[model samples]
Target: MTRRPRNSAPEPPAHFAAADLPVRDCVELAAGLASYARRYGLAHVEVSGPPELGELIEEFGLDEVHFVDSHRRPAVDIEATPRTWRCGQRGLRCLSDQLIDAAHAPPGRVATASTLAEGTVLRFTRHNRLGDALGIVTGLEHYCRDNAVASVAVTGSPALAEVVEVFACERVRYAPLSDRAVSGDAIFARSSWSLPWLDRFHHSVSDTYGGRVRHCVTPLLLRQEPERPEREDVVYCQFDARSGTALPLRSARRLLSQVAAHGDVHVLGGPDTQYYLGHDVTYVRAELPEMVARLLSCRLFIGCDSGLGHLAGCLAVPGLIVSTDDFETTWSFFRNYASLSVIPLAAAELLLS
Candidate 1:
């Protein structure tokens, strides 16, 4: 049996903050609610799985609610995988697991078209995470185009602005993000999506203090400009991530080296260009603009799960993302799917086919 120090205080179970979440993130939001229950002396989470898995979670006092048995997936397209969990289905699965404790405990704020006014200018007040910003802007871009709505965004990021500049309709404007009153009568909207696991995270902040999740269909608008006909066969790779969520550098280098044997490899961020000096690769000290240019020119982008990969998706750049869990598939995997645990190079090879 596990033991604590004789005079030690009893430690409460670990938890997550589940506020406004995208349907895909319902999985994490579910578990977070469970955590809340345990801490408050409500019901402890009841879980079902193999005995070995049960024992593992018993140690953490959790049910291990995440993508399990992913390694068993046939080394190919995710569609071939039997799990029908993606997007809203993740919400259903989490619900089936009885993760949400209170009945509609957290009031959800979903900004569907019914909630937004037409032809009135709306400005979002919150700005964080290039990835979520990308998803939000992409949704807004399409929303404005389809409905002829005038919308605005408040962000300090020129890189994000560049994305809006490239895709958003003329009716949408990029207002500055900080240190000023929100000009005009601004109705708010927020980007809602799932959490990355462990120390891994990309925020899903709302425009309000705890924002509302806006719903809109985000399209792949990467129809190339004829003037940009000279697209090159370069594969872009990035080993960087926020929240310590990136692949180890040595593993990254090895993967890139293999990808390089097929064609030219462009590394996005790493310690130094000198580190991979001998490899058939070009290491770029990437800025948003530079990254955009490279993304536009390359045949594909490959990287650990990160926001830049989301940026690539925003620009309609095809990407292959290596992630620890299937959470991203529920929201964003950029059309390329690969698994972890079995070492993603094997998964990548299947995605390649």
Candidate 2:
């Protein structure tokens, strides 16, 4: 349900306080945020989320919502469009570490790393994956606000744009993921890889709402696959280094083999992934929808803490997330899932059991 915004003056935007509001379901969360903003007695609640979230805010009468279209990495000229930029992959020598630290840094300390030239803007675009780009955007949002930099410009795919638009950026530009060379001054690209967005989103659904978001919006976002008699005892699995570093081949095989002992297990991976995994286990290659279908029909899912792992949890499928060394706290907060730093045969056996 949408929370209609008050006709009165808006409340000052507080990302942290809004994050603490207890609500789920994108629409409800948006309304609650609007209410929170109003309670604070400020005008114009600054909000962001996945791009599609703009509609929800509009439905609630938050017309001036800062819908930041991040996700796209199209080639654009920042000189002419001074207010817009990208979050895609860009190599920054000395500024990368400082920028990442700044996303979580307090308002007072974020301006210490000012690599951008005067009158230039920072844009976020592609890192290795869309998730990576978003993580950088979260940090950049905080940094820009703290540094008194105007809104950031982000460009990418429509789907990515939908997600990024909900983020706290000033403006957004949409374009396909491209290899086009980005050239401009004061343009810092998203380089560091981490999914900080999950944490930021989670806090918004805390308090009164249940901590797990798997219930509020997962069903709407993903269609439930009908049960298959033939797939009754199968376990769906995914293991690849598509976004982050790959889990070791031997570790994955050992875990999968143990899981297979419980019953039939189906492995999911891309073309290159299948080679290292070998043919001993049943391998199924499919696009995202098919992959979702497989997970829905399976007894359980096992995979690294990548995009698929997040999806499995959101779908409320019982699963295990293999956490790598650089595991972020955000990745562990999911419904119906357990995480292990290393592959544990016992964990697999328990999940399948």
Candidate 3:
């Protein structure tokens, strides 16, 4: 058997920016980006709102120097003539126009819009990992090597910065915001210009549940405290598994039994074996906040990488994040949360130590 090499050649850096959207979106985006920018220092940002939005930007030592007024174009104005997808609402039609216009704009300005009948003139590359994201950064670096971007402002995660550094991006910047900013009432009215872009981005992305429970609940969990535990002896466990992985039932049960030796262990989310952890271990399907609260009340959070782990960071709860693979990526995203101690699945036997 052949072993794979660790970290090949570094890739180029990408341009990161944060836009001023609804407070909720802005804060979430900021928290994710701040970690990246702080680590890599990629700066060159374009914000869509006023300077006050800088509060979040400064948290990560990132500066927001440029601002674009929000544009509120009607959805019908941007509708596709042939109509690739059905336009259920008039608002969507208006958004179609904005995307078309943005995509057609000249270079220097970032445009995210639907491809028109003329086809997409803008070059696009998919980045699903650090390498891929770095590839995109490399292309951008070659394009603007001499005239380096003032900086890269990220509103995502630090893992994104590692990709940027691979591209040799030295001027990285970040924006950080607390969970309150994400759930607080809108600080500023929706800008007239923002209306059109928001609609177009929403439509182009095809995000169905803009106002649904998943989106609303995750952010809420970041802000609110979990409900008080019903029973002191009931230990809540949040088993967060990454996209492609599983926890062995026997091993997990053994681990749970050890952790909650004196308490009833309750497992929530991901996998059915949680149901078979014996009479002392119960399972429940609750919303993100409820799940988070339950986990907080419990003695420990034992699972693989997942949104639940990320949520634990936001709650500042002491827990363990299990990652049998991709330890670097997982650590990059959750390190800033300050409450998580990541352990690879191979090291489970040493969990208590």
RMSD of each: 13.6, 17.8, 20.6
For model 3, give the 10-residue run with minimal summed lDDT: 211-220
Give the deviation of candidate 2 from the true structure as CA RMSD. Answer: 17.8
Off by over 4 Å in 1: 1-114, 117-127, 145-148, 177-216, 220-226, 241-244, 270-281, 286-290, 315-319, 327-345, 349-353
**C-alpha positional error of residue 209 in candidate 2 after TM-score superposition, expressed in Å:** 26
Kindly indicate the candidate among 1 and 3 with the higher TM-score: 1
| Residue 85 lDDT in candidate 2 | 13
TM value for model 1:
0.52
Q: Per-residue lDDT for 1-353 in model 1, tens only? A: 87877666433332222233332333333343333443345444333323443333332234333323333322211121124334424322233223232232332332323323443333333334566446555555554455445564545456456656655345456665444424221111111222221101111222222223334244435323324546888888776734245665566666776788789877776555335343456777765655667787888787666667666655667666666445344234344222212225456655444
Model 3 has an lDDT value of 0.39
Candidates sorted by lDDT, best first: 1, 2, 3
C-alpha lDDT score of every prediction, in listed order: 0.45, 0.43, 0.39
Q: Give the per-residue lDDT of model 3 (tens digit) for 1-353.
A: 96546544222122223343544334433332332222233353334443444555453333422233443332111111222211222232333233334435221222222221111111221122322222233322332222333442332344334444322344432234333222111111111112221122212222211111111111112223436676355545655333344566666666777666655666765454444455455667764335556666755566565545654554566777776545554554345556678777667646543
Clashes of 2: 28
> Candidate 1: lDDT over CA atoms?
0.45
Candidate 2 per-residue C-alpha lDDT over 1-353 given as tens digits, one digit per residue, 9 for 90 to 100: 96757664332334321222211234334444443433334444454454445655653345433444442333111122111111221112112222223334222211113322223332223232434334334433444443455554444434345434433344323344344423211121111112123333222222112222222121113223445445468887788745354677777777777777788888777666777788666778765555656777787777765666665654567766765433333243332233223234345445545
Model 2: CA > 4 A from native: 1-125, 128-197, 200-220, 223-231, 241-243, 326-353
lDDT winner, 2 or 3: 2
